[model samples]
Target: MSAITLGAVRPRFRPRRISPARWGLYAFILITALYFLLPLYVMIVTSLKPMAEIRQGHLLALPASPSLAAWVKAWTSACTGLTCEGIRTGFFNSLRILLPSVVISIVVGSLTGYALSLWRVRGANILFGAMMIVAFIPYQVFIYPLVRVFSFTGLGQSLATIVTIHTIFGLPTMTLLFRNYFASLPVELFKAARIDGAGFYQIYARIMMPMATPMIVVAVILQTTGIWNDFILGLVFAGRDNLPMTVQLNNIVNSTQGERAYNVDMAATLLTALLPLVIYFGSGRWFVRGIAAGAVKG
Candidate 1:
């Protein structure tokens, strides 16, 4: 009997040969990955090389002497404009904008989504429809109107203004994300909470929010990256004192007053992009789980 069991398992565990189609698929995936990663590899190597080595124009070669000097200069003393101060100022400014915007947007969106999904509020469908439409509309079309409104409200181009702008723009997508996620949850849970003495806020704070951890991580990642990488909105809304890292990097890269510092430019670009990349990669699993949990469902 043991020999027969072993024979059965051995047949089941037989090594599968790769078909030509499978090989082609693997080759496609490898080529696609390299296509995307090659630019990043070049950027990293270029950032490590000094200007002297960069002048040799060997774009694909590894640095002979990799150094962090360019990274340090890009962070601390690379001239963004008239000032010699580096992108650190914008980095702090981005943090200030990112934290509040992420928190407020997620909180409000979750609340809105929870209410819309679970409650019997009037015109919820219409409101959601309007929001969906607004989401599809290019935000640039509203930029002028928003600027006018902020100016009229005396919130002109300040940290507060930028934060408010991010929250407002983020609401549609965030609400959609949470609303879909919430809608996908078991209705029995909501019914059970209702059967208990639990109230609206109580259900959300105690049960829904906790259960929505994956979605929350997804929201945080989305908001952090979107708000961090935003350039036009930051340029238009954030006051001169609150330019984001992207703006600073742009200033550094585009300044043609002197010889271009390719190493510094690459480093600055990477620095500006690092936060989003880190957040996305670190929480990629959660992001995928959230989407699977019902980010796409009605």
Candidate 2:
């Protein structure tokens, strides 16, 4: 009986050999990670080094004496244009544009998606088709016409114009995202809400919106990244005062009048990218969960 009981308890640990194929896959993954990480590593190291040390030509070496002066200068006094006021101005402008554009685009897109998905609106199919087409068309095609219309209406090159431009461009994709998500939801939920005397807006506001938290997160991430990184649109529509961080970074990097401050340029580029990076990494799990939760299903 003792021997039988001992045999019934299986061994807790076993050594398993990795196959050659598995080893090759691991090597490939490591190589891929290094390929992407090398540039970022160089950027970080370079940003910490002084110009004298950087000029010594050790591109991949750690800085002999690391400092934040470059970062400070990049944030406070790096010449972006005729002004030496740094990228902080553009940072603030980006924030202003990002918040309003994200909120308005997500709200309007989600509502339009909800209406088309559940409600029996006339010409819904045609509207959806047209929007999908617009989504695929290059936005460059509409730039001239949109400029003409906005200028004709006396709304050219301002915060409002930029926000409106972001919202309009974002609508088709936003609507598609929310519409697919809404369509994937159980039909019984909508049916039950209607049976319980919930009006269209009531059902949408209380039930639908509450259940759309995941999609909303996805939309926020996408819009925040897109609007913050927008250079062309900002250059064309954001006016001089409302130029975004990307535009400022371009100016900092491309200022040909003086010797290129590589360290400052690296720091400014990282600064311009930091917000999107933070948002993406902080909410990466939620982004995956949102995508998995029927973001593409229809």
Candidate 3:
């Protein structure tokens, strides 16, 4: 007969329960969130209120007589200078500048980053250093020189010139972002692609780009916000016929000759903010992953 020994089972580990410190941390985070959200709340409430109620100085209070008249005026009838065409023209003009600028900037930046990360080229480090230095310089410093160059080229203040300016300004950061992201990827893949006799563009098109979706989302978010909120560049390079919504909104709110309409100003601001807000909200998971992945090895 064989004797069998029974073995005692070990207990599974359990996570510790939340302590008072943890609860305090949660409370702090919630309070900070609310603090930041208060201004947005005020803006929304003010935009909804009529001018009559606005004059009463109740900023945080809900509107007693809420109406969309201000919104309507901002979108269709607000005067900027001699034009009463609202912000529609500016909106279209922004699109014209934004679309081409975003596309060209991203494409150029991605390619530049890719080459710097993967390919060996002479003076690459020096070129990249120059770009980084340019990135830190104040944008205003370049305005006069860029204006002169544009004027000399006969481009002056056209859509093309503005697009070029955006592309130039956007390059360094965008290149750095993609470069860091690509550097984080496995070198084995590039080697394997090269072993198969794949050219630079072939490898980029087939492998590198497909793996860069997250970084692309991040780049889009950054560029979209910067370009959309840019007042000075648009004012200088976009000309009168190509003024963006920011310029139009500024003109409407800051005109020295007219009585300020608080409700309309707020409404226009909210509207102007809508697109970037939409982009940020819609970016969702990709934005987080992109930043995480890019920063991991940078």
Candidate 4:
């Protein structure tokens, strides 16, 4: 003790240890994650299960023998009505409705938002406010009037009509999304472009649009998911010849007299989901970056 052990007292070294509250927060996060993921887990497991096992009600249980036969039958031979044609018949129809609507909606919405955000055109604010207000209205309120208009205009129940309908319905939300996004951007960006002799279209197409990649991805996601998942609007306007997969799916799942094929039904659901799924998975990385880039702000 007399050896002057002050050297041992040198700043009691302590490692950075996590506090108990942090550990509890991590535990809470894990539980929340599991809660949200439960349904997805059930769907995957159930989809892999055969009808015999599915009927047994242990939907979460591992498949007795995993097979892709349901997926195959769903693609080529599962019945929808009087025919054995599967949901593949309507995949292209969905695309037909999706592409034109997406392109037209994005182009028009972006232009409208850019104008509303940056320009000082007369009555523009009024129009923008009206659009935003109407965006919150349930779409059903407009369907009857729209149908009457479409009928009078001789565009009733056609691909063109559906595309136009999607464009119209998508406008309010699309405009709001881009307007808010563009508003958050620095005004200096537009002014610098203007000083460099950039005109309206020039600034939009060059300086603004390039930086708008994130918002564009968001728009694509929303429009793609909506148009692809659409059943009601497509049913009303997509004509018998152009029925999307959802309509086919409804028929398959609901036909009272038809023998219910659960396997095919699951596969068809998966197929119908493919478009939106592809968009999400493909652009997920950009979506993250774009959000981080301040596409949506407080």
lDDT of 2 by residue, 54-81 (tens): 9986999999889999999899999965
Per-residue lDDT for 256 in model 1?
Answer: 41
Model 4 lDDT tens row, 207-272: 778998878887887788878999999999999888998988787667726456676677778888
Could you estimate the TM-score for every candidate? 0.88, 0.89, 0.86, 0.80
Q: Which residue pairs come into collision in candidate 2? A: none
Q: Using TM-score as the measure, which candidate wins?
A: 2
Supply the global lDDT for candidate 3. Answer: 0.83
- For model 1, the stretches where C-alpha displacement exceeds 4 angstroms are 1-15, 18-26, 289-298
Estimate the TM-score for candidate 2. 0.89
Question: Residue 157 error for model 4, in Å?
Answer: 0.8
What lDDT does each candidate get? Answer: 0.86, 0.86, 0.83, 0.80
RMSD score of candidate 2 (Å): 8.1
Rank candidates by lDDT, best first: 1, 2, 3, 4
TM-score of 1: 0.88
Judging by lDDT, tell me the better candidate of 2 and 4: 2
lDDT of 1 by residue, 17-71 (tens): 9888888989999999999999899999999999999998699999998999999
